[model samples]
Target: MDEVSKNNVIDFDKEINLLRSRECFNETGFLLLRGIITQEKIKKLRSRLEIIFDGSSRLSASIFDFVAEDNFLSLVSNEKINRVLKQLLGKSLRIYPNLTARKATFSPWHVDDAFSGNKVVNNESNSQFIQVSMFLQDNHYKYGGGIDVIPKSHLEETWQIQEQSLSESLEIFRRVRNKSVNIDSVAGDVVIWDGRLLHRSSPKLTEGGVDKYSLMWTVSSIQSNHKEFLTHLENRGKLKESIENRLYDARYQELTHIKRSDFSNFFLEKIKKLDINLTLKDSS
Candidate 1:
């Protein structure tokens, strides 16, 4: 590796060791680090992201739709971010093509693995998934829609609290709220957490509305059975065949019946407006 790559690897190792020892995430279900990315890089990324969001109508509709945009995936393909992810997750990581949400969007409190029949156990080995959110703008508690995490919630074995009704969930949030840390991040600050942790986006309370731009990515260990997991995404009409073919090779054949025609015109139009070239090079 070159100097920059070498330095990043070293730094990543340090962060990984720190992450393992601190228990900060277990205690809070989140951790924050400042200056993770240079100011210049954040400016460039924000510029590109803003153009995409400006043209894409989906961003205003719902957080799920906004996150499924192709341009958002293109943005997260950044090498610097991927390097850190590789160190934390391993080289066989597969990134989900989702960006979490922008302003006015809120993710309900739940665990990603809940649908898979896995409960949040005390051992990390039972945690099958991880999520990382890279903030491209400054987020504050007053801004609302900021992420609220239940510290050490991932260690709980049951979904007793998470299964409650919305009102009940909010009441639980109010009671066990150890620390409601607003992820006030300037561009490039990344927050990594266990997927089983109980997390919800606090409502956006900004005046006249404010756009909270963020890049969210998930990573799973190699043994996490991504093929089966990806099949689930594909069946849900979330994965494109073109990328799926490349990622899964012959495995795509098994899922041929699940493929759907690409209908993400809005997502593609935003990419064109941003002027970011996205032609995939031939692997052969």
Candidate 2:
């Protein structure tokens, strides 16, 4: 695709509005919210990040939720995303704890079957989840990097080539690359794609290049199967924490602070109003 159609990308506050932005996500499997976050908030986050990080990339991103920092939470819960999410998902939204912060990193081609027990995730026909990512700096082909995705790829059955042979994966990639396109965005933009969509970081990984700071998190519609969803979490936790050979540990261990007891009255009440499920103990 040369450029995403107007229907797939919308201004954060443009008055000439569509009746519902949710339709875009359903049809295209992704939506770009232009300038969803202001520069002020992005600047604040960068400053705080400078203090907390030592110029190294890490996968344990649960620190973003620390009540002490409160920097990332402010962005995650902003009204722009909440409104879009509420409209796409129902009034209630359940955000998974699988958030990640990456710096100048590139990922291989794959689909996100996050929290699912096994790799045979073939249920994208009615997907109710999305991966939300926002970059701290501009993402482009010239100066920096961004995501490239196969639009509507969710409609096709996926083959987790990482589990299969390289020859088979190469054959599949030859075809998959025919449909992929680079997605460019600025610091304040938010990019959301369906959980089943085939996507990857663009321009490949380099030795030394512009830093691509991105924060990614997942969200689910409350109407999804809760029991199965909980099981997915259980499997994800055990598989990673137990699996010796792993690139990054599962996020469950880093989410202990989400227990209702850990949240103060102020944030607890706020979280309650957002209908964010504090699933640590199922109480709160």
lDDT of 1 at 41: 71
Residue-by-residue lDDT tens digits, candidate 2, 35-127: 677789888776666555565345444433444444665556666777777777778877654555655556656775542333333274455
* Reference-based lDDT, each prediction: 0.49, 0.64
Best by lDDT: 2
- For model 1, the local distance difference test gives 0.49
Tens-place lDDT per residue, model 1, 1-284, is: 00111111123324444444234444444455444566777676566556656765443323334434554544455454545444445555544433344434455666554322443223445444568776665655566534666656667534454334678766755766664444444456666666766666655665644466666656655556555555454443333344443222222233333211231555445444533222211101
Clashing pairs in 1: 145-202, 145-203
Worst 10 residues of 2 by lDDT: 113-122
State the RMSD for candidate 1: 10.7
- Candidate 2 regions exceeding 4 Å error are 16-20, 55-57, 64-67, 115-125, 142-144, 161-171, 204-209, 244-246, 250-252, 256-258, 263-266, 281-284
Off by over 4 Å in 1: 1-28, 55-57, 60-91, 99-103, 113-116, 119-126, 160-165, 178-180, 235-284
